[model samples]
Target chain A: MPLPPSPPRLSIGAVAGKTVPRLADLPWLIGYAAAFAAAHQAAAGWGGQGFYSLLYPAAGVRLALLWSRGPRLTLAVMATELIVQTIAGIIVPGQAGWLTAANGVARPALTYGIVVWLVRHVAARSQSSLGVAPMPLGLAAVTAPVAATMAALPWTLFSPELTGVSGLRQTVASLTGFVVGDLLGVLLIAPPLLWVVHAWQYRPRALHRPTLRQLAGLAEAAVVLGAAIAASTLLAEIGLGVPAAPALLAVAWIGLRFGRTAGWCAIVIVAAIVLPFTATDLPVAERLALHMSLASIVVVGYLAGSFADAQARAQSDLSRRDRMLFQAERLKTLRAMSVAVIHEISQPLSTLAIEAKHLHEITVAADPDIAQTAALIDRKAAALSTLVRRLRRFGGRSVDEPSALPLSALVETVTALTRAEARAARVVVEVSPIDPDLVVFGQEIELAQAVVNLVRNAVQACDGRVALSAHQNDDRVVVMVANRCPDRREARPGMGVGALVARAIVEAHGGTVERVTHADGTICATLSLPRPGAET
Target chain B: MTLPANQPDRAAVYVVDDDHDLGAAVARLLCRHGHAAEPFLDPVMLLSVYAEAPALCIVTDIMMGDLDGFGFADRVRMIDPAVAIVFMTAWPTTANAVDSVRRYGGLDYLEKPLDETRLLSAVDEGVAWSRRQRSIRARTAALSARERQVFDLLVQGHSNKAVADILGLSPKTVEDHRAAIVAKTGTNGLAQLIALAR
Candidate 1:
């Protein structure tokens, strides 16, 4: 029987490790509820919600909270909204808190849901890049106001709390006031709040307690605030009321001085300084209109600063990519040049060595005692060949196109190749048998080259008394080639091309080659590489 | 100073190289030194000359036209693995060349612009290695079951009395088998026989 095919797996692998809300989330939830209830009461205390709200900041607080915490914390939003709305209903006369609490859940869920979806959609559509992109986040900014207004609109029909029991025109006035207030609140407050939170998180590396430059930025923000407050007070004194149009030219100075994050903070400080003038003795509608103007300047200035930052980031990113491309091309040329030079020299060296050996033999046969000149030539040719081999090893074009290779085969082949050279040097080569199934991820020929270099070096160092051993670590394989030469005074070439090239090849494979000369004169070279498919 | 290459003319040294002049030069040097050496400038020329019997040794360059020294060695290996090999190369830094030569039971390598001494010595070694291999094969072929048992004991350094005691045979019978083994192998004594065993 065909062994009943296993239940068709959805191949989702495992539950994507369920996201657990942390202790940090507990504070954000509690703080959001506290801020919400406090801001609502504050708004009502300044003036009952009609055409204007003096301190409507709950929506802005929600957006700023969600910015860092992510949208998965919708449960936190809804939970906080539930407690705040219930308390507001009980406090406000004739509003049924229990019956209307469902709207609180629905509103945040819809508003943030749309905002999160749009941000995700824009990010997915654009190139996932290394630099900060303000355009997508600017688009996310626009979504918040639209979502807040839309979420509020449906509630207008049912909840008298939002629609109001005033006359139809008054009701119309209140609805416009609601949209203007919420949009202004989110735009004016969320960006600066998010900036502060982000700053606090990475402020160590971001500012390191503010340098002289940062102090200058703070001075600029102080100047902008002082100017905005004086001008707003002058407008109120002259009975022109608060115009709420921020001195844009002066703010630009702050923007230029403070950079984007501190620039947003400066804008917030200026608006906070001018917040008192908007709550003066004027009609609710006029005051609300003034607030809208104030919010407009803040939102527009924030977006301008964001745009400037994104543009600067994009420009640097472009230059860096170009620089890297040019650098990579140069590296390629260097390698090619080295390999070509070695290969060219090899053919001629072969002819030279052979001819020298031949001449040495002839001289010996004819005049054995006077053959030293030929011997000298032969010795020099051999030395040149050794130098060429080292040069080739150093600058050789690595045959290092990577693939998965069995560890045992790698060891066996390298040891076998070095065996004859070992015998010639009077070195005994011993290789420990390893598990044949173990494999490493690397370039096969380059790895072989690296291992062979080590083996050859070992043979040269200690009369070829070498031992090779391999063992598997958790996600890596370590091969050690060791040679024992008890004499300390016999100096060998310290910085050979063979060692350099071996290091290069191993490092390229995300592996390491370490050489240590022991107290007892045992020279050891160890090569370690990540196992196949370990994602190293 | 002399090698056991008595019949040097009978030992054919095949030289393969893409460089025609180099091949001719090496062949000339070997011929002057009393070996029957044949030179082919192209690997294909060697392949084409398959009608002749396989040589006792092949002296080939590592880098050649179309088919390289290694490819030529492999072809020759397929035909007669007993033939010894000696690689002559310009690119001696090629890491795998010498090892592969040793892997195929070749004698050794000669760096290019071939030295008469090294080339001649390599050829001498190749010829001797090839002869020993052939002699071993012939001796094994000629051995009867009982003679093979006697040869195996003698190779282990057993005296004739010891061999007879181990095999439950007469001492004279063991001595007879041992003599036949030595005669078949063309070895002088126990020392040569021991070398042949390796």
Candidate 2:
């Protein structure tokens, strides 16, 4: 399965957590809220309920993406939510003391727990599906719901007059509302928030954009926000009551189009503009209480959003570290294999030196067949030169960049390059029939290096005979390097040099590798890679 | 084969290096100067043929695989201790230089890529030194112990008093030993005495 997309930058905040002092966090939160409020006001009045709802879910997913931190960060977010809510209540003062001050604080704290729990659940499911360990899934699930429920308590208690209806009616309505809001928030806001966190952390080139793309995306978001506000205003003027649903739809649409921050900004703007109109119909105390409660909800949502973002970022970082560790281990194995290659090649070089000296002596004693001996010397020298070049290339020197290379040409080059070394070692190399037109995408030097490594390994593995072959089947080009196993006692552990380097090269080109050991004590390493211009 | 003393042939020099082009070029330069020179790419082959030959001088590289210049020079010195040795190396180190002088008695070290002028000059100096050593051996063969000591001091540019002090003798006695050295070599004056020492 393809790997999940990386999280975005805002999500990384979950990992940094309180590492960023409250003094710094507070201003950013305030700015985010103000932007959110303005966007909400503009979009909800201009756009319909569908747009607002769409915006909320999108914003919620974005926030969820950002919540990368573990339980500790969730708590911090809860605190931030409470603080922001309290401040907004104080500033608006449109509700009763108990409803506005106490209820406002309680609602956000509860929301924080629910959001954290749901995020942990989703992240667990994702990990299990990906076949990796699910990190702290159960912990998040249990703690999140409980924390969110507890945080919501003060709201129910402070506003008992309005919400404390007879029987189970009030309880059911409250529970339903809480579940729907939290679920919507987690699903819609969390994913985008996580994406942002991942993007910021890893900063993959594919996700990067030029200034023009960024500007275009931003401009589109502004237009969407304006439409949301117009819709919200029209709905309210027609005595359709407070257009909360329409305003939410507008937020969702913006979220989908422009991401979380934009969606949340639209939500806040709609709230600011609509809340004042709704407040005018109520008594001073009720108005104050209502205004404060709404503001508190906004603040709570922001904190929860940020907390989710940070957690996602932390998880991504952990995965990235794991990948790096795996790569390092692979490199170490390659280095160990190179030692064997050195041993195999050094013997040939020593023998060649001895033979050259003998040839020189014989030539001086009797100049008979001088031209033939001279040609032989030149040929041997050229072979030794090629061997040295291969060794140097394997030693990690900067070589020519990868380019489009034909499979047949690459095999021919490697065979020619290693012929002298193989001959000195008393091994024979045979090539299998292959398609001349079959081309593989990669640098010729790298492909040659891979082929050379494989041929050398095969020769070393076999007693005296090895075969190098290639074929094309469907979209994949298959190259097989086979050697008769040296006695069973000599069969080294793990993958041999040829198989390892060949596998590395093939995989780097988005291919698969396999090894087969025949019943007759012969080993074959096959590299299957996608042909150039073939759909993978 | 030993050459007759009356012959007018100039002494020959040999150069050995893995680089055939450079070695051949050097040989041509020596030939141009009226000296016979042979270049070899393999030091082992060069050593097997030239070990006993009385060459005026030899030039070789220090980094060859089978027999490096120093090893070849050691073999040459074993065969004939009087032949002059000049070493050429791509990488010159202090230890190798000192070792070359100590082990093979090489006259000088040259770094490659060699300048033609420098190589020729070094070859000339080495040949001249070898010729001087040959003449000294021929002249010193018949000197008595006392005369040999005085002759050595005179070649060192010492005065009569310094020679007497070194030999633990009076100035008159050292003068008598110097007179005997001049008579034994059959030279006329101090300049001729020094030339005879050479």
Q: What is the TM-score of chain A, computed separately for every candidate? A: 0.61, 0.36
CA lDDT for candidate 2: 0.59
As a whole number from 0 to 100, the lDDT of residue A212 in candidate 2 is: 91
Tens-digit per-residue lDDT, A1-536, candidate 1: 10111222232332111123467688878888898777666665335355336446666777777766766566567667776775766434355564444654456545774586558555545554312465455556656766766676556656666445455666666666666566666666677677677677656464357689768867767777678767877887899866665455555555554445655666676666656756667667777676666666666666666666777766675676566558768998988887777766765665667667668878986676559889999899888777876776566525334567898999888987887888888889888888888898766777898899888877887754799999988888899998886532222443255676688788888898877766445777889998887764
Q: Against the correct fold, how does model 2 do in TM-score?
A: 0.40
Return the TM-score for each candidate structure: 0.58, 0.40
True contacts kept of each: 0.12, 0.00
lDDT of 2 by residue, B2-39 (tens): 33334568668887878676677567656655567888
Best by lDDT: 1
The alpha-carbon interface RMSD of model 1 comes to 4.8
What C-alpha lDDT does candidate 1 achieve relative to the native structure? 0.69
User: Residue-wise lDDT of candidate 2 within A58-161, one digit each (tens)?
Assistant: 23421342245433334444455455545645324545554445544445444554555466546545643222222232234223434554565554656555
Q: Model 2: what is its DockQ?
A: 0.01
